[model samples]
Target: MDSPFTSKLGTNYCPTAEDAVEIQAFLAQPLRQMECLDRKIAELQHALNKLLEEREGLGSIVQSHEALLSPIRRMPADMMQEIFLACLPTHRNCVMDAREAPLLLGRICSAWRALSLATPRLWASLHIVDRGEPPQRTGCGRCPSMARTGWSVPTIPFAAI
Candidate 1:
């Protein structure tokens, strides 16, 4: 919606230096009238803030309902598991890095974590190149043992633990 405090400047809106001078003169031409405009401006600002809060609330409600309509919510668990399995590296092995796909799958949602962990195929192929175990809290929050024991197959840590 257009702002309630519609600018006095018209649709044409081409102000010259003379126009600026004239406008300043007009604003001060009436004593205490600027104070009235200020009050109106404050009132409009309050109304705008309230509208913004209301819009945020309305958006949240819409967001809450959006989950129910998602096709992902309706997909069969078996189908999702198949999809998750396909996401794993076929020729090479998967790194334990949280940034990559198979590992990243678990962190996305509880259902995904369960599937990724349960599917033995997802863990069957892994090729890790650990720069080094990250120091505690350096980043990525409590890093997992990546390529530990010289990358002799992680043995499906997600499934095991």
Candidate 2:
């Protein structure tokens, strides 16, 4: 069998000892590197084809052009009010801690923002039950008198209602 180096150099041109050693070292490295590169390329191509096939199968469920908005301009006002009321606290003294969540909801779009701000009842109920026992007299929440009175606020306090 003809070696690669033999074919590259004419038979009359014999390599010096140093040249032979350099050529052997260079060839040995590239053979291992080429094998590693070929294996990695095959693995990547296989993964790419699998992803392409999966994406093609999703159809309208994954369609990029689908509209994000509701088909209607407005839902009935009474229904909206009922939904908001459903979220209200059933007991007195419950403070609505939903301020952050509602603000985030409103930020999604102009209509949602307007609706969230317009609905006062939605922000009315807060569950003081989650606030834990009234802290001892030393220091606690902003309502020091509330802790001193030992009068637990109901889910929706009368003052808030």
Candidate No. with top lDDT: 1
Q: Native-vs-model 1 lDDT?
A: 0.68
Per residue, candidate 2 scores C-alpha lDDT tens digits across 1-161 of: 33547665656777789879968876887799899999999999999999888878775555644444445346776675565456444554334343534334456568765665566555443433333433563233543223222333323333311
lDDT by residue (53-122, candidate 1, tens digit) is 9999999999989978999989998898798877767665676678875789899989888767676666
Estimate TM-scores for all models. Answer: 0.61, 0.35
Worst 10 residues of 2 by lDDT: 145-154
List residue ranges in candidate 2 displaced over 4 A: 1-74, 99-110, 123-161
lDDT, each prediction? 0.68, 0.55
